[model samples]
Target chain A: MQLPSKLIQDAVEEMAKLPGIGKKTALRLVLHLLNSDKEQTTMLSNALVQMRENVKYCKKCHNVSDEEICNICSSNNRDKSTICVVESIKDVLAIENTAHYRGEYHVLGGIISPLEGIGPSDLSIDLLIERVSQHDSEVKEVILALSPTMEGDTTAFYISKKLKSCDIKLSTIARGVPIGGEIEYTDEVTLGRSIMTRTLFS
Target chain B: MQLPSKLIQDAVEEMAKLPGIGKKTALRLVLHLLNSDKEQTTMLSNALVQMRENVKYCKKCHNVSDEEICNICSSNNRDKSTICVVESIKDVLAIENTAHYRGEYHVLGGIISPLEGIGPSDLSIDLLIERVSQHDSEVKEVILALSPTMEGDTTAFYISKKLKSCDIKLSTIARGVPIGGEIEYTDEVTLGRSIMTRTLFS
Candidate 1:
């Protein structure tokens, strides 16, 4: 489609580059930016650029950070001895939303996906192992909170093997029926796991 | 959720303000931008800023343009005598994509929606009437190509009443079975319209 101007076309193309946004949606977004306050576009543009230019990663856990260490890793109140391992800052946010875990985190960046040619070397697995294996370590347990996909399991297995020599214990989130899921609608594998792993009514 | 960085949090908030994006999708898009080449983010940011700062509107039709008058309005190749009235630039684009209409366009920006408190005075309806009314009249037809909704019908009725003083013909797009639509699945209203407006089978 012929846009009214080159600037519009360029903006639409750029907007369409984002995942899940089609050309029509991109055009709608661009047109919205055009009709909205100039300051809004400026704020969005500046925020994106600022993030791309200045956003740093936590030195210890590889989480996105303004400084070398993220707020989660540096907080004294969090359980430093129990680290939750997962992929990406998004996962960190999701886990934090649950408010169940008070442990420090180990962000692996991404799991071991051979299909995408992403191996152990591509991620921050070494940093996590080193963080757990330090002498006179306070790190006692490493919980693998990665997704239960094949790649996630593979990544957890590789990291656990490397941390075996260390004093840290390895664990994972249990696979069972979701907390609010109805038993009738639950899949067999999950329902069966929930039943098998059921603790005596306590 | 506590984001790892202020930059990320700000960007996510700004991105989430878009029509369909939520916080989670905003984070995903922002993270994707981070992992991609800085050039992509820079280009997107620059395009948005440039478009917002410099985008112009066609003087005659009020469509988005890079110059005073849009190409369609000024072009000698298009039928200047026939003006297609539309609700927004998106409508203009949809019609333009068909390559079916060679007429000029008069963008109303939005329809007369009482619920949204948008009246005829809020649009470019006055400008459209003025264009059709100058002495030494060149205009022959005014096509109401607005959507076939309640608001669209109201706006069309209003414009047709105003254009009654002019010697130009007023028309609307045909509403019937969409191309490639199955007869069994077609709605009753559209099927009835198709029958009522039946033409020569040639």
Candidate 2:
């Protein structure tokens, strides 16, 4: 689309660079900012700049944090013996929101996606091995909470192989039909897995 | 959702404030930014700030511009004798994209919507009247190209009443079924209007 103003066009272009936003949606957002109070735009810009400049990754877990270590990694209440391995910081947040898991997290940064040219080296897998193998480490069990995608499974298998000599138990989160999912609508692979891994009734 | 970092939370909150963006989508965008190169985030933030700080509205037509007057208003190629009035800057762009109209535009900024508490004084109506009534004005026609909504009609009627004393002719954009619209699915009001105002075939 041909924009009348260069400033708006620039802003729209920047907004369109986001993953899901397109030129039309970016234009709508830019126009909204232009029409609204100047303070709102200033606040948004400042917040984004501050996030980009001041945010840090947890040295231990690779999760997004304001400091060298994330809050979960530093907290005493969290179970340091069990580290939930996941794809990204978003997965960490999702697990945290459940409020059921008290274990610390290890963000892999991403899964092993060969299609995207992302391999084990592209992720923080080496950091995970180093973290678990550290002398005087309290880690006992490493839970693989990665997604059920093929790449996630590959990453998990790779991590399990690396941790084989570390004297740590390796486990993966259960793969089954979702709690409220209908049997008829469930995909064949998931349904088959759910049937094969049927749990005992209490 | 509970975010690990305050900076991430702040950015997500600001993003969620935009139209159609929810907290989850905001978080997703923020995470994508965090995972990508820092330069991308910096560029987006800088573009937004620059757009907000430097952008200006055309003094003549109220359309967004980088200067005092918009390109269309300043261009000598446009017809100075005809003025097309629209509700917002987007409308001005939409009409310009058609390339059928050669006249300059007068952006009302908004329509008269009592439900939204917007009135005539809140828009640029007075400036439009003043421009049309200028002693040295060459304006001969004012086209009301506003939307066909009730608020648009009210605003157009209000403008027509205001410009009744001027020597310029006043006209409105024809209301009819859209070019590619299916007749069976067309709304009754639009279909009725189209039939009532049907033009003779040459």
Candidate 3:
């Protein structure tokens, strides 16, 4: 829709650049900002710029950090021998929220999606290999915790092939019905595999 | 949920302050920005700050503008004798999108809401009256195009009372079943009102 003010139009266009935000929603958001306190708007703008300018990535895992080395990598309480590999920082946050896995993580930055022109070279796979090969490294097991997509599986396979010569054991997160999931609604392939790979009760 | 980095947390908190965004959605948007080119983040931040700093409001209509007098108020193509009153700039854009009305607009900035502590004093109601009172002003009709809600009606009623002595006409937008609405699923109050205020075929 046509807007009368150039400043409003400019603000809406910038906001619409965000993912999942359309022009209409952007206009609504901009209008809300226009009506709100100017200091609040400044705070938001400053926060975004500051985050982009001063944000740091972990030297080891590549996750976002306030310093060169992330807190997770420096923490002595974390299980350094077990490393979980995932695609993005969002995945790292998601897994951390679970409070289940005590192991550290290795962010791949992205999966191996040839269709999208992303390959093993585009990711930090080599750094992972280098980290595992170090004689002083205490890593005993590497867990592939990527999503259950074709790209994730392809990346995991490539990594497994690369790590075969190393003494470290390779494993993957279990594929089965999720907790509180109903079997009747579960897809056939997942259900069949879950049944065939059933584990003995403790 | 706990975030690993302070910078990421600050960005997320600032984003979450927006009208409809939650912590989860804010985190997703912030992470998307972090993963994207740094230039895009700078552009967004600059646009927002620039808009907030340079934005202006029309002297006549109080709609967000880039100059003291908005383009709509200065345009000779629009009907100078008719003025459409609205609660916000968003309503002005919505009505302008219809391309049916060629009249000037007076943005009240907000409707009178007691629960929100907003009263007629907080609006630009006096400026609207003054615009209509000036002898040189050719405003023969004032149309109330506010939303069909209690607050809108209250604000309209107050404006009508204030304009009682003025030698001008006051009008309100018609309310009925939406153009393409299903009658069966429509609420009874709106349907009954539509029937009670039925108009003759054109």
Candidate 4:
């Protein structure tokens, strides 16, 4: 193989670092960049650099934000009394995109996985609980929007135990074979979560 | 739907600008960056910017370079009288990595693609022709290292016609089913190229 310029190879290597992007895919991206106009490449480069520099976590919700508090947490139109607890900021955005959810979010940074050395103390569970308790009007609901993974379930269970003493309604995102999908391919974690989160369908 | 922060969405949009990457994949990449260590993300960002700013084309061969002439063109060990003609800079690198071809390279920039409105005029054909005529001790060989596509064939034919009067041995890379591949699963293009570039056992 001929050695590519160090700069071009560096760009490909950087792109390949992204999840699911292999070397071939990264090469395609680099080629695209090379073919594109200089103005566009500069825009992409500037955006990448600015993304990390300009964006920050909201202090109140731990969601990605450009301000001290995320827009979701600070907006008066949202249901502040009902905060959904999720494993990461991406989950918050996913739930929000559904448009059916009107409540704010609380990001836990990550789920609990004892095998991976991540525990309750490592996450933002304490902060979530503290937020619920400090609310003046008494929070109504705490919805768990963690993934269907083992760590997500473990974190949910641990959080549930701590919030059990509170009077708030605790629930989780629905679980089942995905919409219009076969059950055979469903992983053990999803199947287990589906069973655990099953509702009484009258 | 809760709107993703402008900064976060902007990053995703920039990622989606890459060829073959859609919005979902871009979002996944952005989330991965969001989860990665600060230093890693910084390095990737810096590398992307550096790639655009630091790289330039080699004046001698029209291959990608960080200096006036590429390493291959400047090296005294290489066969300066032999020029490998390729469709792109990537091809030059691909040939270089084999470490077998000890010669200079000429990047045609792209093959003749009438469907895409690309022609000989769109490529660096003129420069390549000029190089051959101007150089002393007429080049011994010009290896065609283009993809085995219709456009590549047309471009190669055009170049050969232009250099018919010159004293040079013209050759092309081999085409066939890959070493480990079964004929049953061979792609049409490779199979077709193999037929077109067939050689007799005699």
* Candidate with maximal DockQ: 2
Tell me the tens digit of each residue's lDDT in model 2 across B49-150.
899889988998888899999999999999999999999888887888899999999999899999999999999999999999999998999999999989
* Alpha-carbon shift of residue B13 in model 3 (angstroms): 0.4
Q: Lowest summed lDDT over 10 consecutive residues: which window, candidate 3 chain A?
A: A1-10
Q: Tell me the DockQ of each model, to 2 decimals.
A: 0.81, 0.82, 0.81, 0.58
Report backbone clashes per prediction: 0, 0, 0, 7
Candidate with better TM-score, 3 vs 4: 3
Candidate 1's displacement at residue B155, Å, is 1.9
True lDDT of residue A199, candidate 4: 78
Query: Model 1: how far is A93 from its true place, Å?
Result: 1.6
Please give the distance, in angstroms, between residue A110's alpha carbon in candidate 2 and its true position after superposition: 0.7
Docking class of 4: medium
Ranking by TM-score: 3, 2, 1, 4
TM-score of each candidate structure, all chains considered together: 0.91, 0.97, 0.98, 0.87
Q: Candidate 2: DockQ?
A: 0.82
Against the unseen true structure, what C-alpha lDDT does each candidate score?
0.91, 0.92, 0.91, 0.81
lDDT per residue for candidate 2 within A1-202, as digits (tens), equals 7888999999999999999999989998998998889999989988888898899989999988999999999999999999999998878877888899999999988899899999999899999999999998999999999889888889888998999999998999999989899999999999999999999999
* Lowest-sum lDDT 10-residue window in model 1 chain B: B71-80
Off by over 4 Å in 3: none
Candidate 4 clashing pairs, residues 3+ apart or interchain = A1-B97, A1-B98, A2-B93, A2-B94, A2-B96, A2-B97, A96-B2
Give me the runs in candidate 2 sitting further than 4 Å from their true place: none
